[model samples]
Every structure is written in structure tokens, then in C-alpha cells.
Target: MSTLARWLLALFGWKVIYVPPPAPKAVLIFYPHTSNWDFFIGILTRSVVRLPARYAAKDTLFRWPFGWIFAKLGGVPVNRRERTGLVNQLAEEFKRHESFYLVITPEGTRRATSSIKSGFYRLTMLAGVPLGCAFIDYSRREIGVLGYLNLTGNQAEDLTNIVKLYAGRRGKHPTQEGRLVFAAESARSGD
Candidate 1:
């Protein structure tokens, strides 16, 4: 799978850089998710780096035939309809697995937005795991996980560092790329 992913990326003129060692448990925050293609690119990068990561999706996506396929591809379903302790569930998942990488797109959408969702940050703080910064830089034609962030639980300061990691990295659709606003501002503005 890794070989196939590498070949596909190379065939498409995409390059991976600064691959980090797979973490036993961590949150992978992929930035600038400005296109549906970001999902495919992210999957390819995950395989290329040989990371055993599972992405979170609404429980609805785990319904029928596609559910099995997504499961095989490391999709973890969450019931978003209610506050069902998803963070706790994921935290337990980390405790259960010797290795787990939970991939999240804080932008939470393909269209341009004012700010990022705070769930990813809250999840990491609750799970007692480090947050990893991964990016798809369309301008550079590169995709890879840089490394884990040194989070101190201060949302604004920590987010500032995360944003810094993605400095100069543009998305596939630059116009659609959302500005990563702080969680407090996002909440206050009802984004």
C-alpha cells in the first residue's frame, strides 16, 4: 500500500517531505482543507508515511457497503447529533490501541470560513496526546506531517504556533482556504 501510494503521488508530481516517525497515539490536524481532493491527498500521504491513522467522520457515513470499505481504510465513526462524549471515546481508543493516529481537519469544511473548529484542540487536551501538524501545500506541491506541536493548553498561544507551522502553505483552492481564527473568536461569532 505504501509503495502504491508513493507511486501514485510521484505519478501526480506530488512530493512528501519531512516524514515523522509514526506516533503511538496522536492527533493529526491537516490544514487548509479547501477541496474534496484534500481527502484523497491526505489518504495517500498517510499511506506513503505508513501511519496507522483513523479519520473521524459522522456516523451517517458508516451506514452501508461504504461503511465496510471506510472501516478497512481506517475510518472511525462518531455520532455528532449529540454530545456523546466523542472525545472520551477517542481517548479510550488511544488507551486501547498500542498505536492510534486520529486525523482531523479543523477547518471542518471545503469552503472558505472565518475560523477553525475547536474540537481538535479539545480532543488532544482530553486525550493526553500531542497534536501533530500535517499540511497539503498546493503551492509547493508537497504534503507531509511536520511534527507534533508543543501544546500548553492555552488555545490562542498554541493555535498561533500551529498556524505558524502552516505559514506560506496554500491550499489547492487558495481563494477558498479559510482564515484560521482562534477558537474563542470562532465561538463568539457563531461560525
Candidate 2:
């Protein structure tokens, strides 16, 4: 898998910049998720690093003829409209596995937004795992898990640290870069 990933990355001109955390359990959150291409690139990078991570996507993505492929690739279908306790469910997954990495595109969509969803933060805290800040810096043509940090239970302070990790990284669509704030945070602040 790594060989194929390397070959494909070389063919497409991308550099692998993976730096996974030592901990087996983590919530790997990808920032500036501005393009659908992040999914494919992320999959390739995961293969290159041989990281086993599961990710949640809208339920629609898990439907139809090609849904099996997505599921086979570790995709979890999620219903945004439903009031399911996904965070708790996923936390249980962590407890069930000795090693688990839940990759989350907190923006929840490729479109730009003022803030990201809070599920990633909640999941990390609930599961008692580190948070990995992954990136796909299009400007540098580099992609992979970049940094990991233990949350201090202070949302504001923790967000600052996460932002620092991605200071200079630019997404494929710079204009669509999402903010470091969480949806609930911004909403409470009336942003």
C-alpha cells in the first residue's frame, strides 16, 4: 500500500508530511478542508503512513452503488439531521478498540464556514485521547497528519494552539478556508 501510495503521490506531485502521534488513540482533525480532493489525498497519505483511521461523512455519501467502497475505506455514515449521539457512539468505539484514530473534517463540508463543528473537540475529550491536527497544504504540495496536542479542557486556549499548528498552511481553496472556532463557540459568541 505504501508503495502504491508513493507511486501515486510521485505521479501527482505531492509530498507526504506525516507525523503521527505516539498514542494509539487519537482524534485526527483535518483543517482548512476546502476541497473534495482532500478525501482522496488523505486516503493516499493514510496508506503511505499505514495509519488506520475511520472517518464520518454525511449519510448521503454512504448510499448508492459506490457506498461499499467508501465503507471499505473506513467511512462511517452519519445523519446530520438526526439527533444521534454520534460523539458518544464514537467514544465507545475508542473504548472498544485498543488503538483507534477517528479522522474528522470538522468543517463538515467542503464549503467555507465561520466555524467548525464541535463534534471533534467533544469526541477527543470524551474519548480521553489526543487531538491530531492534520493538513493538506496545497501551497507546498504536502499532505499528512502534521501535529498532535493533548487538550487542556480549555476550548479557547486549545483553539489557539491548534491555530498555531496550522499558521502558514494553506488549503487547496484558500478563499474557502474554515475558521478555527467551533460552531457552538461562534454561536454562543454571536459571531
Candidate 3:
């Protein structure tokens, strides 16, 4: 799978930059998720780098037969309807796993938005893990894991830094890319 993924990415003129060393637990959040194609690129990159990562998807996709396959591919079912306590559940998963890398799209959707969902930040903080910032720079045809940022438990400051890190990075649809902003409650809560 690694070899095939590498070949396909090379054939398509796409490249992956730094892949960090394996960590016991980390939240890998990618920015500029403006296209559905990002999921395919992310899957291939996961294979190419052989990273042990799990991604959250809507729980509806986990119904019947396909659920097993998705789970095998490290897909975690997220029940968006019951939004509360998801971060705590994910944190528990991290605690149980000796090594876990959870992939997240802070934007929560492909559509344009002004702010990122604070779930990723809250999850990492609860799980006591660093947040890994990955980027898909469409302009450069590159997908790279820029490594992890250790959160200081200050939501506003941490989110601000994360947004700054993604500055200058381009998404496939520039106009649809979300700006990373957090809610005022998140900024004040410090939780």
C-alpha cells in the first residue's frame, strides 16, 4: 500500500513533506479542507507514511456492512446529533490506546466559514496530547504534516497560534477555505 500510494502521488505530481515520528497519542488536524478530494489525499498520505491514525466521520456511515470496513481503515464513528461528550469519549479512546493519532478537520465542513470548530482543540486538551497541524497546499501540489503543537491550555492563544501557522497556505478552492476563528465562549472558558 505504501509503495502504491507513493507511486500514485508521484504520478499525480503531488508530494508529502515532513511526517513526524510516531507518538503515543496526538490529534492530527489538517487545514484548508475546502474539497472532498482532501479525504482521498489524506488516505493515501496515511498509507504512504504508515501513520496509525483514525478519523472521525458521521455515525450514519457506520451502518450495516460498510461499518466494519471503515473501522478497519481507522474511521471513528461520530454521532453529530448528540454532540455533547464526544471530546471526552475520544479522550478515553486515546487513554486506552498505547499509540493513537486522531485526524480531524477543524473546519467541520468543506463549505466556507469564518471559524474552526473548537472540538479538536478541546479533545487534544482533554486527552493530554499535542495537536498536529497538517496542510494541503493546493498551489504547491503538496500535502505535509508540519508537526505538532503543544497546547498551553489557553484556547484563544492556542487557536490563534494554530491559525497563524496556516497563514499563507492555499486550499484547492481558495474562496471556500475557512478562516480559523474560535467562538468567544471558547476564548473565555479556557477549558
Candidate 4:
């Protein structure tokens, strides 16, 4: 574990309660990403679990000194505003790399929203990889990996089952709501 990650663990008193499947290729999904602290807890969880997971962030944040640090910490910068397709770009990245664990937030933001972006499902489908669930429960100061969800191109059914698995999990971020909220809403909207 990196020093920053160790410091975070000490500061937050985080503990991983679940161990995910040992998959070579997978997309890890995180919920209720409503604050910057979500990333902090995520870093600690990843380090404690000893997983070589990578996450995407806005391109602008990868500047100079900070960029160097992010790269060392396994950050993949994505151009969110680019007119080019995102799924294709991520698919290509996945194809280029022999093994990688990409982390994505289904909610896509910290604020309360009624729906989840389909990029996570689309990325896994295009890359032909499974989905892993990473969750943080602030109420319990617990962070866990909820195994893997093998995608079968049936977005509605697959997501429903996945969300049901994490039905009562709470969000670590303050502004964002619980995972159940987004999961239930996603199921209702069929997104």
C-alpha cells in the first residue's frame, strides 16, 4: 500500500468485509459517488484489498505533478466532452492492455439523481469482461468488494440482479444517496 493510501486507512478506520472473485479482467462498479471522499475511501479499500484497479477521471485533472501521481496510482484520464464515442475508446484501451481492472461509478456523479449512466454496462459488454461491485458503507465504516457479475448483454436483467445484491448498502459520500436509491431507480427506469 502507498503512503497516502495507508494514511487514509488510518484516518478513516476502513475495513474490507468481503472478497471478490479472482478475475483477471473485470469492470468494478462503485455507487453513490457523491463526494471527493468517495475516491479517498476507494483508494484505501483498493490498497487494503491489494487489487490493481484503475479508475477514469476527467482529462483536465491529469495535469503535471498531480498527473504524475495519478498515473503512478493507476488513473486513466478520459475526455468526457469529446465527440468521439467513449465506449469505443475504453474498449480499445481494454484490448490494448493484457490485464486491467477498471473502476466506474454507475451514478456518474455525487448529487442525487434518478438514473444511472449506461456506460458501465456498455463498457463491460464491449470489452467482454465481467462486472465487480465495490461498495462503501459510511454508517459502518466498511468497504467491500461484492464479487463479480457476468454480463450477458441483458442490461435490464443483469443490472436488476446486481442491484438487488446490494439493496441495502449506503453511500460513503455526504451529498449522494444510498446505493438502494440508484439501484431501485435504475431498475424502475429500465436504465
Candidate 5:
């Protein structure tokens, strides 16, 4: 099914707009992840771009016949409710792997939030890797990595730059005011 999706996307001329030279070993950040279609578009984007990216899904999604399919499509099962420290686990995974690229949705949900979660930032920092921005703009029919940046741990300033980069850019999903709100909060909190 994954291969079929890739082939179909290719036949339709769905291509990557831009990809960084010497793709860095890092986590890929996807924003406004709000629907199931985001998965299909993301897969198509990865296939078209030939990017080795993986995304986290719920543990329940890993069960049954679909389990193999999801695994083949680079879906990593995550128990969101568990008390385990996910950043630590991801950092360990990065440490063990020479080249790892994981896709994370900063929104963390299909519904809108007033603030974006800081997990992706923390994970990238802990793993000592850069962060690449990926997006699916339905209106433009493009799915690709826009750019990469080194996080300086100044959440406020860093997020300001990121938001500016992605602003006015349509995504496969919708963005709530949360990202902007969080950016402001981070500035105030000095996080």
C-alpha cells in the first residue's frame, strides 16, 4: 500500500519543491497536523522527496493487519498516556542510530490548541540534532521540507523566527492561534 501510494503520487507529478543539501540528521517538525489526510500527504511528500522520515502514532493504531502497513509506512507507536519520559527515549534512540529522522507534530492534536507543545524542541535539543520544517500546502499541491535550523534553546526567539518562516503558508491542517500564543508565553516565561 505504501509503495502504491508512492507510485500514484509520482504519476500525478507530486514532487518536492526544495530539499536541503546534505540532509541533516535531525527531527522533522510538522505543524497544524489536523486530519487523517495529513498522513497520506505526508507519506506522499516523503516518497516524492525520498526522505527517510518517521512519525509517531497511537499504540492502538499498531494493532491488527494494519500494524504491518503502518510500520512499513514509518509509523512509530507511542503510548501517549504513559508516564515514561518520551524525550529521553527519543534521545536514546537518536544516540543509538547514526542517522535518524523523526517527524513530529507540534500541535500534538487534530483540534486546535492555544499553545504549541515544546516536546519537539526538547527532543531535538536532547538528541543534539537540527530541526527541519516540513509542510503540506493543499492549495499549492506541494509537500516538502522548507528549511532547517539549529535551535538555540531560546524558545521565544527561536519560535518567533520559525513562525515567521511558516507564516501565511497554508498547511495540510489548520493552525490555531496557539502557536502564536505560545510564542508570546515563551517570551514572557524565558523558556
Candidate 6:
């Protein structure tokens, strides 16, 4: 699998800068998710790095004949309609596991958005896990973890540091890249 991933990535002029996760249990953020291609690129990178990470998706995506395929690929069903205590439930799941990497795309969409959703940040903080800053830079044809941050409960300062890690990184569609600011940040500041 690793060899295949390497060949596929290098065949397309992409390079993987393997930065191991800071902890066995973590919440990884992959930013600048502006294209459908990001999923394939992420899968390739995951295989190359041998990252045993699971991604969350809508509950409906986990049904039918193809559901097993998604499960095989590390998909965790998320009931977006009923998010009450979801974070805590996931946190408990994390505690039950010896190694778990919950990969989240905080932007939560492919279109340009003014602010990010706060679920990733909240889950990371509540779960007491490092937030791994994973990135895909179209400008550099690179994909890897930049670093891990143990976020302070202060959302603003913590978010500022996360944003800085992504400096100079470009998404496949640079114009559609989502901003790092969360809506909660604005609400707190009365913006």
C-alpha cells in the first residue's frame, strides 16, 4: 500500500513530508479543502504516511450496499441533526482506543466561507488531544502535518496560532479557500 501510494503521488509530482502525529490520540485538521480532489489527495497521503486516521461524514453516507466500503476506508458516521453530546461521545470513544486520529476539515464545505465551524476546535479541547495541523499546499504540491498544538481553552489565541501554521499554503482553488476564523470567535467579540 505504501509503495503504491508513493508511486501514485510521485507520478503526479506530489511530495509527502511525513510528520508523525504528536500523540497516539489526536484531532487532525486538514485545511483549504476547496476541491473534490482533496479527498483523493488526502487518501493517497494517508496511505503514504501509514496514518490510521478516521474521518467523520454524514450518517446517511453509511447506509446501503456501499456502506461497508466507506467503513473499510475509516469512515465514522456522524449524526449532524443530533449533535448533542456528540463531542463527549467521541471523546469517550477516543479514550477507549489505544490509537485514534480523528481527521476533521473544519471548513466543512468546498465553497468559500467567511468563518470556520467550531466543532473541530471544541472536540479537540474537550477530548484533551493535540490538534495536528495537516495541510495540502497546491502551490508546493506538498501534503503533510505541519505541527501539533495543545490548544489553550482561549479560542482566539489558539486559533491565531493554527492560522499561522497555514501561512503561504494554497488550496487547489485558492479563491474558494475558507477563512480560519470561527463564527464563535466573532460572536464572542460582538462582531
Per residue, candidate 5 scores C-alpha lDDT tens digits across 1-191 of 55775678667666556566254478887765667877887887676566778897777888997898999888888777775788889889888887789998887766767677777899988888888888666656666778888889997788877887677656555553236446458567664
Clashing pairs in 3: none
- Estimate every model's Cα lDDT from 0 to 1: 0.83, 0.89, 0.85, 0.76, 0.75, 0.87
Candidate 4 colliding pairs:
34-110
Residues 60-93, model 4: lDDT tens digits: 7799858887778788887767655887888888
**RMSD to the hidden true structure, all candidates:** 2.1, 1.3, 3.3, 3.3, 3.5, 1.8
Candidate number that wins on lDDT, 2 or 5: 2
Ranking by TM-score: 2, 6, 3, 1, 5, 4
Off by over 4 Å in 6: 186-191
**Weakest 10 consecutive residues, lDDT, candidate 1?**
17-26
How does candidate 3 score on lDDT? 0.85
TM-score per candidate, chains pooled = 0.90, 0.95, 0.90, 0.83, 0.84, 0.92
Please write out the lDDT profile of model 2 over residues 117-150, one tens digit for every residue.
8889889999999999999899999988778999
**Clashes found in each candidate (C-alpha, N, C closer than 3 A):** 0, 0, 0, 1, 1, 0
Error of 4 at 48 (Å): 1.5
Candidate 1 lDDT, tens digit per residue, 65-101?
A: 6788777888888776788877777888888878888
Number of the top TM-score candidate? 2
After superposition, the stretches of candidate 3 with alpha carbons farther than 4 Å from their true spots are 64-68, 185-191
**Stretches of candidate 2 exceeding 4 Å from the true structure:** 188-190
Stretches of candidate 4 exceeding 4 Å from the true structure? 2-11, 173-175, 178-191
The total of clashing pairs for model 1 equals 0
Error of 4 at 166 (Å): 1.9
